[model samples]
Target: MLLFGTAGIPASTKTNGDTVAGLKRIAELGLGGMEIEFVRGVYLKDNMVPPVAYVGKKLGLKLSCHAPYYLNLNHADEVRRRQAGGVLHHAAGTAARAGARTIVFHAGYYLKGSPETVYDAIKAEMEVVLGKLLDEGTEITLRPELAGKISQFGNLAEILKLSRELPGVAPAIDFAHLHASTGRYNSYPEFAEVLNRVGEALGRESLDDLHLHVSGIEYAKTGERRHLNLAESDFRYDELLQALADVKAGGLLICESPNIEEDTLLLQRTYLDLSPRT
Candidate 1:
C-alpha cells in the first residue's frame, strides 16, 4: 500500500515542543508516514532516537528524511565539495538512527557547466558519499530528488541515469517539481509515461518502492517559484493519483502543501477512492 503523510509536523506545534510528540500526533491523525524535515539542518539528538523510534514503531508510521538544502555536489571549490559530502553523510546517519529507510536530498545546482559536465561531477561525488555510508554500515538509501527548476542539477532523466550507475541511489520524483520543470504534463497519459520510463530504466522494484513529494506549485519560465495549497493551485492531483494507483506504486508520498496535514489526508483519501479496486 502507498503511505501518505506531511513533509513535517503539524504547524500547531510550538517551536519548543517535542518532536516525538509530533510523530505520535501524525499517527493519531491516521497518516501512515512522516518526512522528518531536516531541510534546514540535522537537529535530532542521539538521545532522542530511541524514544522517537519507539513512538514510530508503536504507531506504525513509516519514516523518511529530507536532507538540508545547502548541499552542492558540483561546487567548483574542492573544499566545498568535500563539505557537501559531509552534509550528506550526516543526513544519512541521522536518517538511519531515526528508523528512516530513505534520505532525500536536492543533489546540487548547475552553476555554469553543461548538463553532462554537471551530471558527471555530481555522480562522482555521490559515489564517494555512498561509499562512506556503506563502510560505516548505514542501511539508509540516498535519494536524489527531481528538483523544481531549470537551473537545478536534478532532472528526471539525469537522476534516473545516476540511479542506474549508483548501487544504492534512487530518485525521489516530486510531481510538483516535474510539473514546474516541464511547464506541463499533468494528464494521466503523461504521468503514465513517467512511471513507464522509471520502471524501464530502474526496474519494476524501483517503481513499486517509490519515494515521492507532491503538492500544488506556482511556476514561471524559469520553473517553480513557490508551493501552493491544494485548493489554491492548479495541480491536477486527481489524475496524478490515478496514475500512481494504476502502477500500484507503493511507497511514501509526502505532501508539501501549505496546509500540510489537511492536504496529506486529502491525498490519502483521494488515492483510496481512485484506487483500482474501488
Candidate 2:
C-alpha cells in the first residue's frame, strides 16, 4: 500500500518528544509510517534502534530515515569524505535496527566542475560507503535524493542512474525539489513523466515500493528558498495525487511541509479520494 506519514516526530505526539510516542501518535492518526529525521546529526544511541524497531513493528508502521545534511561526496578533501562516510555508516546500522529499509541523503554539490566529474566522484564515494556498510553487515538502501538547486550534483537522471548502477542504492524522488529545480513539473503530465521514468529505470518493483518526498516549495531563480504548508502554496498537489494513484505507486510518502500532520493527512485523504481520471 502507499503509506502516508510525516518527516519527523509529529507535533501532536505526547510524551515529551519520544520517538515511540510519535509512532503511537502516527498510528492513532491513521498514518502508516515516518522518516526519522537525523538531518542535523546522527545522534541515535546504540540501544535505541531495537526498541524503536519493536514499537514500529508492533504498531504496523513502516519506518525510514533521512541521513545528516552535511555530506558532500564530490569533495577532494578526505576529511569531509571521512566525516560523511562515518555518518552514513552509523546511519545504516541504526536505520536497519530501527526497521528502516531506506536511508535518504542529499549526495553532494557541483561546486566547480562538469556534471560528469561530479557524478563520477559521488559514485566512487558511494561505492566506498556501500562497501563499508556491507562489510559491517548493515543492510539498508542508500538513496541519493534529487536535490533542489541548479548547483546540486543530483538531478533526476543522476539519482536514477546511481540507483541503476549501485546494488543497494535507490532514488528518493522529491517532487518539491524537481519543481524548485526547474520551475516546472507541477502539472499531472509532468508528474506522470517522473513516475514513468522511475519505472523505466528501476523497474516495476521499485515503483511499487518507492520512497518519495512532497511538500509546498518556495523557490527563486537559482532554486528552493524554503518549504511552505501545502495549502499555502501553488503546488498542484491534487494533480500529483491523481498521478500517484494512476501509477499505483506504493511505499512511503513523507510529508516535509511546515505543518507536517496537516499536510500529510491532506495528501492521504486526497490520494484515497482520487479517481484514475481525476
Candidate 3:
C-alpha cells in the first residue's frame, strides 16, 4: 500500500480556507493522504475536530501531523526543556483529535553537546511525553524526523536508536534530509541499506508502516536549505521509488515540494510505473 500525499493543502485552494474542506478537495484530486502542517503551531481548536474528522473519515483519507519545528528538548534550561515537552503533548493531543495516526517533529538541536549526551537528554524528555500520552490514552505515535543539518540532533542513526530505546516512538525518515545530510547517497543499494538498517534496529513492521517526508531539497556543505520541486532539484526519485516498491513499504510518503500536489502526483505516477505488476 504505497501512499502518496502532499504536506499541506494544495496551492490552488484559498489560503486559510476551511481545513476540512481543503482536505476533501485534495482527496478528490486522487491523492492518497494529507499531512497537517503544524510546523508553526498546533492550530486545530477543539471545536474544529468533529468537522475535520468527519470529512477525513468520509473521504477515506489518511492523515498525519507535523509538529511545530521549534522544539529543543536538549535546552540548557530545564524550564525550556519542559516547555518543549508541553508543546509535543499539545501537538500529539491535537493530532489525535484530527484523526492523525502519526505526529512528526524535529527532536532537538546539538547545541554544543556531544551526540551521546544530547541523545540521552532527548530520550529522557521523550519518556515523559510518552508517559503523558499513555496516561491521556492518546494512540498517535510520536515520530522524530531525520534532520537535514549536521548541527541538529536528529540523524538517521540517532533517530533509529531513539526509536529502539523508547516505546511508542518511531523515526520519520525524510529521504531528502538523508540525501542532504549524507551528501548524496540516494542509489538503490544505499536506499535498500537504509530500509534494512531501520528494519534491523526497529523491526520489519516499522519499515512496512513507515512515515516518510520526500521532496527535492537544496543543500550545501552543512545541509538542507529549502525544498525544491522534483523537476528543479537533483534527487533521484525514480530509483528511490523503485527501492520503496521493492521493499513493499506500506505508509504515507508526504511530499514537501514547493509545488506540492504536482510533485506528489509525479511521485505517485513514478511509483506506479516502476512497481512490478502482480
Candidate 4:
C-alpha cells in the first residue's frame, strides 16, 4: 500500500503556480501523494485551503506536510522554545485544512546537553504542541523525523520513544537520513533489521501508514552532505524497497532527491517489481 510521490510539487507539472495544480500534476503523473513543502512557513489562507483539499480529494491523492525546518524544540531560551510550539500548532492547522494526516518536522539539535536532557526538553515542547493541537480540534499526527546530523536531537530510538508515548505521533522514517546518520543500513539485512526494530518498538500497525522519505544521499561521518539522484549515488535503494515490501510496509514514500519525480517513479517501479504476488 506504499504510495510513492514527490516531496513537493512535481517538477514535471505543466503549471506550478499553486499546490492544487501541483496535486493535479502528481495525479496526472500516476503518483500517489505529495508533501506540501512548508519548509519556510505554514501559512495557507482560509480561502486557499478548501481548494487544495478539494483538488486532492477529487484526484484521490494522499497528502502530508513538511513543517518549517528551522524549528528547534530544545532551544535553550524559553521564548524560542515556545515559538516552536506555535509553529507546530499552525502546521497542524494547515495539515488539517489540506486533508493531510501527518506533519513531519525536524525537532531540534542537541547543543551542549546530555542526550537525556535534550530528550526531556523536546518531549515537553512536543506535549505542549500536541495538547494545543488536540484542544483546537485539528487532528493530525506530528512526526519528528530522524535527523542526519550527529548534533540533532532525533535519533531512531528517540523518535520511536516519542511516537510510543505521545498520542497522535510517529516517526517519519527517512532512509537517507538513517544511512547518513549512522553510515550503516546500506545492505538488505540491515534494512530488514531497521524495519524489525520499528515493528518491535511501535507494533505492526505502525507499519500500516508509514510516512517515509527516500533518496540517494552523500554523507560523512558527521552525517548528511547532500542528496544525489538515485542512479548517481550508491545508496542501496533497491534492497531497501525490497525490505519494505517484505515487511508489508504500506504508506507514502516521498522522494526528496534533487530529481524528485524521476526518482519517485524509479522507487515505485522498483518496489512493485520486487513485490511478491498476491
Candidate 5:
C-alpha cells in the first residue's frame, strides 16, 4: 500500500517547469507521490495551489511536504522560536490548501538542555502551533522528523513520544537518519524492530499511515554527513524495504537521494519485488 516518490520534482523534469509540470512527470514515471519541498520556504505560491492539487488528484498522486530546514521549534531564543513556529504554521496552511497529507520538519537541536527539558519545550511550542492550525481548520498532519545527528532533538523514542502526546503530530521516519544516527538499524531485524516500536508506541493505525524518507547516507561518528545513491552506500535498503513489506506498512515513502527519481524507482521496484501489495 506504500506509495513511492521523490522528495521534490523528478530530476528529469524540464528546467523552468513548475510543480504542476513535476506532477505530470511523476505520473509519467509511474511514481505515486511527491514531497513538495518547502525547504527554503513555502514556495508553492497561493495562486498555484489549485492547479497543483488538481494535477495531483488527476494523477492519483499523494502529495506531502517538507518544511524549511531552519525551523527549530525549540530554539533557545524566543524570537527565533516564534519565527520558526510562524513558518511552520504558514507551511502547513499552504500544504493543506494544496491537498498534501503531511508536513515534515526537524523539531530542534539539543543545545545545552537536557533531553527531558528539550522535549518538554518542543512539546509546549508545538501545542501552541497545533492549536493555531486547528483554529484555522488546517488539519494537515504535522510530522517531527527522526533526526540524523546526536545533537539533534529528535530520535526514535522522542518522536514516538511526541506523536503519542501531541494531536496532529506524527513521526517522519527517515531510514537513512536512523542508520546514520545510530550506526545500526541497517538489517531486517533492526528495521522490523523500528516498525514494531512505532506500532507499540502510537498504535497500529500509525503504521498504516506512515511517512517515510529513504536514502543512502554517509556518516561519521558524529552522524549523517550527506546523502548518497543507494548503490553507493551501505544503507541496506533492500532489507529495510523487506522489513516494511513484512509489516505491511503503508504510507508515502519519499526518496531523498541525490539521484531522486532513479533511487525512487529503485525503492519502488525493490519494494514491489518484496511485497505483493503495490
Candidate 6:
C-alpha cells in the first residue's frame, strides 16, 4: 500500500528533537509514514536511534530520511566532494540504524560539466558509498531525488538511469519538482506517462514500490522558486492523485508542503476517495 506522511516532524509536535513524539503524532494523525529531515545536518544522535525505532515500530509507521542539502558529489574540489559524500554516508548510516528503509538526497549540480561527465562522477562516488555501506551490513536504499532546478543533476531520466545502473539506488520521483522543472507533467495523462516511463525504464516492480514526493510549487523561467500549500498553488494534485491511483502505485509518498500534515491528509483523503484499491 502507498503510505502518506510529512517530510519531517509535524509542526504541531510538542518537542523538536523528540522523534518519538513526532512518530506518535503521525500515528495519532492516522498518517502512515515519516521522513526524518537531515537537510541541515544529521541531527539524530546515536543514543536516540533505538527509541525512535521502537516508537515507529510500535506505531507501524514507515520511516525514511533526507540527507543534508550541502551534498554535491560532483564537486570539482576533491575534499569538498568527499565532504558531501560524508554527509550522505553519515545520514544514511544513522537513518538505517533507526530503522529507516530509504534515504533521499539531491545528488549534485550540473556545474560546468557535461551531463555525461557529471553523471559519471556521481555514479563513481555513489558506487563507493554503496560499497562501504554494503560491506558494513547496513541495509537501506539510496534514492537520488528528482531535483526541481534546471542546474540540478537529477531530472526524471537521469534519476531513472542512475537507479537502473546502481544496484542499491532508486529514484525519488518528486512530482512537484517534475512539474516546476519541466513546465509540464501537471495533468493526469502527463502523470500517468511519468509512471509508465518509470515502469518501462526500471521494471513493473518499480511502480509497486515507488518513493515519491509531492507539494504545491512556485516556479520561474529558470525553475522552482518555493513550495506552497496545496490549495494556494496551481498544482493539479487531484489529477495527480487520480493518476497514482490508476497505476496502483504503492510506496512512501512524503508531502513537503509548509503545512505538511494538512496537505498530506488532503492528498491521502482525495486519493482514497478516487482509488479503487484503497
lDDT winner = 6
Candidate 1: stretches off by over 4 Å = 12-17
Q: List the residue pairs that clash in candidate 4.
A: 2-251
The ten-residue window of minimal lDDT in model 1 covers 10-19
Query: Which digits, one per residue and each the tens of the lDDT, describe model 1 over residues 127-238?
Result: 9999999998999889999999999989999989999999999999999999998998788889989999999999999977899999999999899999999898989999
Q: Provide the overall lDDT of each model, using Cα atoms, as 2-decimal numbers.
A: 0.90, 0.90, 0.89, 0.90, 0.92, 0.93
* RMSD versus native structure for model 3: 1.4
Worst 10 residues of 2 by lDDT: 41-50
Candidate 2 per-residue lDDT over residues 1-278, each given as its tens digit: 79998999998987866888999999999999999998988766778778899999999998999998887877668788777777777877788889999999988889987999889888988999899988888879999999998888899999999999999999999999999999999999999999999999999999899899999999999998999998888899999888999988899999999998999999999998977773
Of 2 and 3, the candidate ranking higher by lDDT: 2
**Model 4 alpha-carbon drift over 4 Å, by segment:** none
lDDT of 6 by residue, 184-234 (tens): 999988998999999999998999889999999999977899999999899
**Worst ten in a row by lDDT for model 3:** 12-21
Clashing pairs in 6: none
lDDT of 4 at 159: 96
Task: Give the Å shift of residue 106 in candidate 3.
Answer: 0.3
Candidate 4: C-alpha lDDT: 0.90
| Candidate with better lDDT, 2 vs 5 | 5
- Model 3 accuracy (lDDT, Cα): 0.89
lDDT tens digits, residue span 1-278, model 5:
89998999898999554899999999999999999999988898789999998989989999999999999888889989988989988888889889897999999999999999999989988988899998988879999999999989999999999999988999999999999999998998899899999999999899899999999999999899999999999989988888899889999999999999999999999888886333
Candidate 4 local lDDT, 113-173, one digit each (tens) = 8999999999999999888888888889999998989989899999999999998899999
